[model samples]
Target chain A: MIRPLAGMARVGLRFQLAYRSDVIMSVVALVAQVFLLRMIWTALYGGREHDPQGLTLEALLAYLSLANLQAFATTPIIPRIAHFRIRTGMVFFDLSRPTGYLPQMAAFQAGHTAGGLLMLAPAVPVVLLVGTITPTEHPIGYAATLALGYVISVMMSLLICVIGFWTLETAAISMLYRLVSHFFAGTMVPLSFFPGALGVLADALPFKYMGYVPAAVYVGHLSGGQIGQAVAVEVGWIAALAALLWAMWRRAHRRVVIQGG
Target chain B: MAEVVRTLRLYWRLQRAAMRGALQYRLNLVIGVATGVAYQGSGFAFVWVVMHTFPAIGGWSLREIAFLYGLRLTAHALYVLPFSSLIGLDWLVREGELDRVLLRPLNPLVQIMAKRLGVGQLGDLLAGLVLLVVALPPLGPASALFCLAAVVGGALVETAVSLALASLSLRTWNTIAVRVFADDLFSKFGSYPMSVFGGAAQWALTFVLPVAFVAYVPASVLLDRTGELNVPAPVAYASPLLGVALFALAYRIWSRQLRHYQSTGT
Candidate 1:
């Protein structure tokens, strides 16, 4: 089981490496985005020592920069791949293979994520040069929550991909999901900036674990107790989403139809 | 002039066919437009949230910023409505699709653009028009007319930029990333008041990318904030003409690059 997963991962890594130019361009774009966000935040702060959200400008910049980097690292392509395979009637071949489709996909996604992180190394220096980052006091806690966040993000993305079994055209749906998740995840602005009821809604959703929680933990916005709670919540979401995905996959497995000749 | 009119009429017919083809995917078409609206709406919502916390950004009020955002989005929609198919230029070039395009009597650019009518951008147009109606300050007849002209002009500027970048695909270069990056720069920075950026960044956006000409200069003119503009008031007023000029130049580049195209011979 482990050997096949490892072999699938190698295939995924090779696929990613084939798009080296894309990785370089993505890194450049990420740096530009971090710089743009920095400028916008600085302009909004207007040289003020204090902020309404109770964050200093540096802290806010740190949170945003880290969030952007994290978002870049965990970019999901499984849904896109699934949609394409299903649309092109390639899923038949995938199913005929001895390995389980879900596990194979998960391994491929892991490998793709590994490639993204490797490309991310170049952008880190450029991001640091863009602005100051608030060092996290609890590095171990930050790492643990971030790992949990990555798991939650992958599971959520796979859940969306599984829906492609029903709807062959998942492109628009996936795009909509991305836009909604990107906002609710606090990649654009901190959930702390969300006013009253909106804040409550963001909190209620599991999307926050994907971006906001880890970044907040990194910038020391969350207390140790809060980090513990976030981890617990993230684990809960992972279990629930995994169960839902398992059930959906079973249904999807029975319903799979080859579309084109 | 007669030749030009005939070409345009033919172009219109081709575009209608493309639209009909797209409409066949009824569910995809509806979802695509809704997704476009939600995409642009959520972007503006982020700004709205930011405005709630901070009184203003770069000395522009929320209403004024919304006006600017609407103008940019409307122009973007207009540009993308016709030219969205050009985003697939790399694929077309790689697959030697241009070999077929060159056999047509009309201009290749028109043929490529007429491949599809972007349904998603229709939603952007809807969202932008609503914002313009809600956020626009009362204006004189001339100013209103100028706003219409500015939207067309801004669309031309965006078209010019993308067209020029996409021309690289004619040489079989994979330019999707760069093209997307350019689009991102426009949507992200073009909505903001230019004064918010530092001098070098502002100058680069204006002179290098010409993103400033898309919506910022015209919005500044309409908002009566030309006094704060880096360029003179006359330059701001004449900003629309820059679009016409840039588009003409970009078309020349496309033609020149097309001459260098080599078929993949698959």
Candidate 2:
């Protein structure tokens, strides 16, 4: 399984590299978003030590930049693949393949993510030179939490994609998901920055574990124990979402087989 | 002149047919519209959160920033309602659909655009209109007229930008990334007053992309909120003219690309 997945990852990497312009365009868009967010936060900082939130200007800027970087670097491709497969009735072909559909998808995404990191390589220098990259007191805890957070992110995307089995207007489902996730994931704004009530709502949602917790962990916002708790919570979400996706995939596969579509 | 009028009439007929087809999917239409409103509302809500937390952003008050946001959204929806279908050029080109479009008697651009009206964007238009109406106190007649003209101008600039980038799909074989990038740029930047950005970025938005003319300059001139910037008084007041000029340039680019469009079969 590991060897085949590694091969699939290599294929995904090559495929991503072949689309040089897409990669370049994504990087360009990432830079533009970072610049736009940087300007807005700088303006909000208003040359003060910090707003009422107690975040130093540098700290806030650092958080904003890193959050965006993380998002761009780890953009989920499985949803897109699943979307295409379901839309074009290509899942029928996948079902007949020797490998398990879920593992194939996971391998493809792991590979694509590796390729996407190349696009983000240029931005790393920019973030380091200009951004406030907060290092956590507990590097090991941060790494573990970050990895777990990524698993939860992937599972969430898979669930959204698998939902296409039920709806012809899958784009709508994906768009709605994008809207909700971007808000709750702290891609648009840090979860900490949400108003008191909205902050509570964001915390309740699993989306924050996708982008916010990892960055928070890096920024020392989460203590060592809190990092452990965050990872545990993320693990719980991963298992729950994985189960949901499994049940969904089973029903969808049965439908495809029975309908012969 | 007669030819242009005739073309416009045909386009209107095509649009009406598309609308009837869209009406069949009533639920989808509702969802689309609601999604549009929700997306635009989120941006406004983000601004609200920011302004409520901090007194002002770049010296623009909440109401003033809301005005900018509302104008951009309204203009964006107006442009999208007619031309959003053009964003699908990548799919059309890839599927060899453009060959069929090229064989048609009508102008290819017009035919492509006339296939669908973004009825979903009506929600954005309504939301933006409500926000603008609420944000502005009763304006003088002249100011109101200017605001109306600005909305038209801004919409034209936006549609022109989409068309210009989409036209490149003929050569690039994929223009979706560019379209997405442009949308990201406009939505992220358009919500705020341009003066907040650094000098170079502000200049890029003004001259290179001309997005400032879409929302900021028009809002500034109409609201009498022009501040310490190097934008000349006359040029800032000529936003409508600027929009027209930018659109003309984009159309020229599209026209040039059309001539370069060789089918994959060819």
**Predicted model with the maximum lDDT:** 1
Per-residue lDDT tens digits for candidate 1, residues B88-125, read: 99898888788999998888888998988899888999
What TM-scores do the predictions have? 0.96, 0.90
Give TM-scores of chain A for all candidates: 0.96, 0.90
Question: Residue B144 deviation, candidate 2, in Å?
Answer: 1.0
Angstrom error of the Cα, residue B106, model 1: value is 1.7
Residue-level lDDT of model 2, residues B1-266, one tens digit each, is 98899889999999999999899999989888888888888778778766667888888889888888889988888888888788888888877788999898888889998878787788899889988888975689988888889999999888778888887898856768868888777778987888889899898988887788788888888767766554887777888887788789989998899889877763
> For model 1, how does the per-residue alpha-carbon lDDT over A76-191 read when each residue is reduced to its tens digit?
88889889999999988878889999888888889988888887787788787685785689797789889998888888888877888888778887888788888898987999
Question: What value does the lDDT take at residue B232 in candidate 1?
Answer: 94
- Whose TM-score is greatest here? 1
Q: Give the DockQ of candidate 1.
A: 0.74
DockQ of each model vs. true complex: 0.74, 0.56
State in Å the error of residue A186, model 2: 1.2
lDDT of each: 0.88, 0.79
**What DockQ score does model 2 reach against the true complex?**
0.56
